[model samples]
Target chain A: MVSRRGFLQGGAIGVAGSAIGATSGSLVANALNNTAAETATAKRQLPFYGKHQMGIETPIQAVTNLVAFDLKPETDRSSMLRWMTLLTDDIARLSRGEPVLADPAPELAIGPAGFSAYVGLGKSMFIKLGMESDIPAGFIDLPAFKMDQLEEKFSGGDVVIHVAADDPIALSHATRSLVRDSIPFASVRWTQSGFAHTPGVVKSGVTHRNLMGQIDGTANPQLNSDDFASVVWMDQGPEWAVGGTQMVFRRIAMQLDTWDQLGTKSKEEVIGRKLASGAPLTGTLETDAPDFAARLPNGLSVIPDFAHIRRAAPEAFKERIFRRPFSYEAGISESGSVDVGLLWCSYQANIEEQFLPIQRRLEEFDLLNKWTVPVGSATFFIPKGPEPDSVIAQALFS
Target chain B: MKKIAVLLASVLLLAGCAPAGQVEISDAWVKSGEMSVEGGMTAVYGTITNNTDKEVTFVGGETAIAGLVEVHEMAMIDGEMKMQRIEGGLVIPAGESAVLEPGGNHLMLMQLTGDLMAGDMISVKFDFEGADSITLDSVMAKPAEGGDESYHETEMDMSN
Candidate 1:
């Protein structure tokens, strides 16, 4: 599978090379000159500008905040344009390791720290702004599943800003800066902060574990590959979404107490993957394809019928989603249970075709459901990235 | 069904520890289990410190809210998570504590008599192998906290 980190490494080099190439010669030779200037600074910086938004395919950061905002009752299209313009300026400065023009805490924004921000729109935003026609055909809210126990707190918002960085200080600063900038046009709807492995805890290229201790993101589409481009980036949506994707943010709460009852062997049977190595029951390595038909002496399937992978994996080749989930631990419930779970985030070219079919299968009868519950949910149409001198969502507003 | 039957019959004993004092519970509380149009389930969590020199086994528990108050565990199985009743008793070693927090090991309250709301206190009796059962009253409150249980709107000003 194409790893997100490897993809960003390649992106960083290309971006740095192009920055130098810009001053050299012909477009093709500037590309050559760009290669000559590969330096330490270039490797550390992720390109701020691209055809697609940066955060979607960027390597998972050490810390992140997924925040949504509801438009103020009197805010209109002009107010939205102003909000986007200011947000665009702030992002451009921060992505380049600088502070916003009028930043109150310039010190907090000193290091870019691999910062990237993705902005998206909700269905309500379209209706309120009288741009319902621009809402992409694939941008509808997720249909309710039988297993969903959604609460309104973590649910709806008109706009979402997914900000992340390798440093918690940088990520936190950016989150505040953006939200502060947004206050005039919108009210805070909800905000969820989460993390993965601290920068160096895991070996490079390894998948991160969820709160449940399962190695996740193993079956994701190869980042920056042709398959990923086709499966995640939009081509048939409104012009604004040409290189964008649909996003789903669901806050799933894990029932850790009940989950503790199972033995290691029983746990293995539930997920069809080994806890220690994250490999399939019929395979020894994490990357080996599962042998679904392999059975035991009693002729039972090696991976049970209701195993999560069996249901989550689709029979149709094109039905797939790029899951980029982050583990969240807000606090403790009144009962002293940990308020922990995955900020279940995913992106795909089309929600109706790529994501729903698989979720439907899991909802029907995945053994995993017994210990995990979906308490919050929302969907957004992430607009394509901004070009230099232009703002995010510019294509849609224009 | 087969798994439950096998687990129920399985009994475990802790080999070492102080043989006196028995098991004790602390910080015991409950979140009012919501029973909206969709059915709901609530849980009880606390610290069970084994005071005796010998290990004590948790066989099960009883409560009036549900027809059955079984001890259940939740963990990642086959890359997916699952919660199941302990067929064999959960063993607590002497001098050590078995902390029942949400998402780990706790009392699974099912078939509630009515919606468990905040300010409500319910009674439950815990059964142990080496000592007599102890009944305690637990208070129910909202899951997590803040206005109407919303995380973002209530916590916007809080630092990440």
Candidate 2:
């Protein structure tokens, strides 16, 4: 494993320092002298720092969802146990910010990411069983979950756990415990790194890259912005969890064969945002909301009703979830078939009340629904990770 | 005689050293690999060269881009990859190049200065050991894939 110290690069620090500096925009003028002449700066700073030590200053967090059902549930219990053990160990390492276990090793590995630390929670049977109906059809291993269906539905999950913390060591300890416990699981997904911010403040929008080359996630929600993070990140989390938020990871893959055929315009319309720039159809920028009621030259909604953006964010500030997701490229077959899609994720205090409504609405009508499929789906309720106390779900579920 | 010899040796070492304009930077911008032209706050990308023989310890740097710009390191703990700040700014070895690549090591530019045009470049000076300063450059490239051509071609260059 590459030691965290070894991966240290001065450039990263340089940028981080600058980010912290920029956030003090209001304070900057005050440092020297805030003149009554220069209109006193407005609303100091956005309270949404995420749930980590860095907050908006934190580099984009990459998440990968690896979901492989114990399809038969009867396929060699011993093998499943061993697989879970390996996965458990891997999760421990990942939570701590270590790389995936490999020979030569990928250039980038996983670590606790920051000093914020994290929590890894293993779901109890009750949550899993209850997931049967309310969960998306995809997680049930249905057609929508298949690489062909691309309906972006949930598939049943065999195991689920959430690992997150600002401090690498904290994440490590939690992950190690899971491994020692001999949990059964598989990593069917991974979150790539990137950030989406309000138009002028940060890199705005989800013009993220999919393995297939076309900018993916054009239609996904764009949270993590100051306004949203502050409003969306609930303060009910424990004190150590301050500056940190909650997270949900879903392993959803897209149908490369069919999606590659759609024109860029078709893809954009399906997502409700521009494919090239990620801007909302109705708004000038990606971070801006699409003027759903705004009419086009032909007198139609600028962003169509079935568009993902509209479905995902119906009421402006009424319902919002902080989203930091990644597009993955795994399970590619030689026969022109592939499993490449998003490691769908979001951060919120209440999943049932806050997140599900948007997801259900999307499932009902998103036009892009025809292009992406959710194969291996699992819901991991992550708490603001930090403090050596205990895992997040432990307190909530146990 | 020993004292004289020591003094002479010290003088030689100091004399041979050429002044490296306290690590200066010309162009600096912050963005992730997945940056866009139309995006208001464009992800910034840039390069920082030590330009000196002595190791340059990074204290911290700042910019007007976002509400704050932090030096973030992208690390892969186990399976989850996360970005964070190194307590003491990283150490830049003498006579070498340290790159801020996408998804790995980068400048988390927050509140931006202006609408980012694809070709536009921003400026930010770096503060290093002592009053040591380095003016570097942040070049806006095509939205990257976490790694660049130079990154893949010379994997062995990382003496680390």
User: Which candidate's TM-score is highest?
Assistant: 1
Distance from true position, residue A264, model 1, in Å?
A: 1.4
lDDT of 2 by residue, B80-135 (tens): 45555656776778766566655556655544554443223344556677346543
- For model 1, how does the per-residue alpha-carbon lDDT over A20-53 read when each residue is reduced to its tens digit? 7875548767576556532222234577677898
Stretches of model 1 off by over 4 angstroms after superposition: A1-43, A333-335, B1-160
Q: Taking the tens digit of each residue's C-alpha lDDT, what string does model 1 give over B1-160?
A: 9655433322111111223576777545565423311134566766678898888888778877665566767655566445566667778998888977555777766656666543334667889998778666432232222112221221222112
TM-score of each: 0.63, 0.42
For candidate 2, the TM-score is 0.42
TM-score of chain A of 2: 0.54
lDDT of 2: 0.45
Q: Give TM-score, chain B, model 1.
A: 0.70
For model 2, residues A1-398, the per-residue Cα lDDT tens digits are 75676556555786888888887875876665644412221111222123342222233333322222322333233333333333323343343344433212323443344312233222322244342222221111222322333222343334444333333343344343433222223332222222222222334343445554444444334444666555445455445334344445565567668878888777777777776566787666645646778888898887888887778874544456665555655566888586666666565555556666677777777777677665544444333432222223222322
